[model samples]
Target chain A: MSGTFNDVIQIIYLAAASCFILGLHLMNNPATARRGNQVSIAGMIAAILATGAIVIHDGLITTTGWIVLLAGIGVGSGLGLYTARTVKMTAMPQLVSVFNAVGGGAAALVGIRDYSTLGSHVAAATSVTTLLDVIIGSVTFSGSVIAAGKLQGIITTAPVTFPGARIVNMLLAAVTLGFGGYMIASPSLAALGVVIAAALVFGVSMVMPIGGADMPVVISLLNAFTGTAVAMAGFVIHNTGLIIAGALVGASGGILTKLMADAMNRSIGNIMIGGFGSGDTAAAIAGPAGAGVQSIAADDAAIQLAYAAKVIIVPGYGLAAAQAQHEVAALADLLEARGVDVSYAIHPVAGRMPGHMNVLLAEANVPYPLLKEMDEVNPEFARTDVALVIGANDVTNPAARRPGTAISGMPILDVDQAKSIIVIKRSMGHGYAGIDNELYANPKTSMFFADAKKGLAELTASVKTLVG
Target chain B: MTLLTDFIIFVLSLWVGFEVISKVPATLHTPLMSAANSIHGIVLAGAILIAASANSLIGYILAFLAAAFAAMNVVGGYVVTGRMLKMFKRRTVPASAQAPAVNAGQNGGKSA
Candidate 1:
């Protein structure tokens, strides 16, 4: 390659990196987030184009190779387009998990292919990265798949465990590490295969114990793993673009995971145990303590909402399951028009993923300022006239305030602090934590049984007639 | 490139990434994760390199699969993120300005 061409390629890569940085900076603010996404897309296009130029100039690809490349592009782009276009907001977590699996699996394949092709001679540095890539990437691949399955309910949303689950998990990790060390020392394809197999099993064991409630943290952790694997793949290929991009993702994901764990007040260690109570209310209600649940009609609930001076709506996975974001938004609008102060209290881990409620609410065209985080909204719940919970369960449970419970020490919305609480739920079902929500049993709280979508629409209709 | 140089670049990039992402508001966390997911699609470059050099059938197959996965990460990530962000428009944006901007972006996106 000519010197100028090589320099040009490097310059374009540097330009792409800068764009990524600028794009992320812009994404920090909601007003500029769309532009940030556009900028990142531009960066991606530039990087791809530059790489293509390099490949063509070098005459590096054969006819068959080009065919393979095009075929891959076709398959990948088709799947991407379909999923991105058609996936519902509630299924976003599952989709993200699937994407993580693909990304991690691909990175692992890159390392494995390169390592296998390198016959007897293997440099220490290269071997290290190759082994790391295969181990981390394979783990991420399988772990993410399991996480997606659990989120989608293909696998039980409740934590799955056996008598010696922790011991088994430790054994799998040890074997994977042992294989990784052996592969690094011998640089043999056979040893590498063992490493990959063990790592994949280890990934499954690691995530299988975690229940549905902890998926956001698990997904974020897997996101970080995917990044590290990509960075290792970068080392294998000697590509700066991969290294920078991968490292960025790794660092960002790691921070986000920690932040999420902190928000729950449960260390990542505790959540990983996978049995944070059955996360089902049936198990919870069947336990030693039982309390009567007061039921209310939609009209009565609407009466409280319409007459209230301040209303705080708490939405959870139930609200998302029934696709009632629009209805809830409508209900809020109706209440606000009747001179009630309506705002949302979004728990950090409300839905399957982080910011799940925010995305759904944003979709309903809810004004951004009306949505408040747990910390910001908790204090206001005291002054609230009514705390209306829609399909929310564990997050609003008063049991979280006491020890010896599944969600003990976990931060909850101060819904119990409100003067009156109206809960809209399908039934007295256990939440993801499989414990009975003490909030439902509180004398001040009344349960209005209905699906989230139907219940919200009914509430909205009732509010309209009562106030106007 | 020397491994030392690469290590330096990797460490520096990690810091840059951490600093940039920390300030992102909670509301945009999903889109942030999605965008980062798209950025890591640079693995496609590595996949391409492998495919170009592959001589055997297994090599070609692995490289092709890797490329496909990487492409999916890139395309699906960016598109879904865009879709999510599309829903986050400020309620304050005047209807007239918003419509034309979206139309122009759609056309620009196709051509670009």
Candidate 2:
């Protein structure tokens, strides 16, 4: 490559990096998130262009290679677009898991291809790194797939625990590690294959025992593993871009997984052991007796919200499942227009994952200022006229902190402290954790049993009419 | 050096770049991008390694610059992300759920 061109490519790469930083900055706020996304994309485009220019200058890839690359790109892009458009919000977590698996799988494949193509000519250090990449990558891929299946309900979300399951997995993981070590020593294709197989089995076993409630954390952890594995693969192949991208993903995913695990108040090891929230234990906590606690209709709920001098809207998994964010926002707008104070009370673990509720609300273009964290908003509930619990169960369930409760000692949103509580839910089914919510039965609480989307739309219309 | 190879590389780069970018959600863009900034470090590492092995001074100089830029990206990216996470923490409810001093309006009375 010409000196000037190389310099330009370097500059472009730097520009792309800057865009990435800007994008991340914008992502902190809901209103600016879209702009952030756009900026990052622009950066990525510049980086790709710069990298392509350099690779071409190296004279390594040929015309045929280029054609194949384009075809692969076309196929991958088509599939990605289709999936993004067709998949429902309810299935988003599963989709993300699947994507993570694909990334891991791709990284493993790259490692394998590099090792096989170079064979003994590759350095001993490179061989070891490659073997590690394949092993970790394969495990992350398979585990992520299982996690996705569980989240999608294609497989049961209950912990598929069998007697001696932990022992069996431990033995398998040991064998996999042994094979990985052998591959590092010998650099043989056969050893690598064995390591891959063992890793795959280990992944399946690792995810199979985790119940539905812990899938989000598992997925995040797996995503981190995938990133680390990809970075290893990048190291083996001497690809700077891949290494950077992979490491970034790995580190962030790890942090996210830790944060999510903390939100659930469970150790990562405990989550992997399975059966923690399974069967009767979960049932005892989230039963229907807890379901029938208290509820009210749309008209009455609207009246409460409309007439209230101060109102707090608490969103949960139900809101996401119902895709009722926009409607909820509309209702809030109506309430605000009517001179009724409206603020969102968001619990850390309210949705399926950490910040899940925030993401959904942000998508609806809700003002960032109105969204209050649990600590900030919980106190307001006491003086608040009404606390609207929308499609949330366990987080707002006062039973969490009440004595003798399964969830006792867990901190929860003090929705119970609100003068009146209006819970909007479809049915009396317990949350994933299977704990009965006492908020439903409180004298001040009333259940508005309807599909979250339908119910919120109705409420929005009612609020509009009332205000008019 | 060939035109066809260059064209192919360009197309492939664009495709990969666009695909990754498109998958990012608005909610994740900031974090993901910040996270991706770590890529610059990878570039720097690669440049340094190549530079060490290269016979030419130009290669060494270019490699050094790349590595330096990438390191900057890594340091800067983490600082921003840390700030963002801190912001998230700030919004959390108070540890104690006790009512504040001023009664904004209603007391903790039950509403039928």
Q: Largest TM-score belongs to which candidate?
A: 1
Residue A436: error of model 2 in Å?
2.5
TM-score, per-candidate, Cα-based: 0.93, 0.75
Question: Can you list each candidate's DockQ?
Answer: 0.41, 0.05
| Retained true contacts (fraction), each candidate | 0.73, 0.04
RMSD of each: 5.0, 11.4
Tens-place lDDT digits, model 1, residues A74-101: 8998999999999998899999898899
Kindly report the TM-score of the first chain in candidate 2.
Answer: 0.87
Worst 10 residues of 1 chain A by lDDT: A280-289
Query: What does the lDDT read for residue A172 in candidate 1?
Result: 82
What level of docking quality does candidate 1 show? acceptable
Q: Give the clashing pairs for model 1.
A: A279-A432, A279-A433, A279-A434, A280-A434, A281-A430
Tens-place lDDT per residue, model 2, A140-180, is: 88998898888777888788989999899989888888977
Work out candidate 1's RMSD over C-alphas. Answer: 5.0
Minimal lDDT window, size 10, model 2 chain A = A279-288
Q: Which runs of model 1 end up more than 4 angstroms from their true locations?
A: A277-293, A402-404, A434-436, B92-112
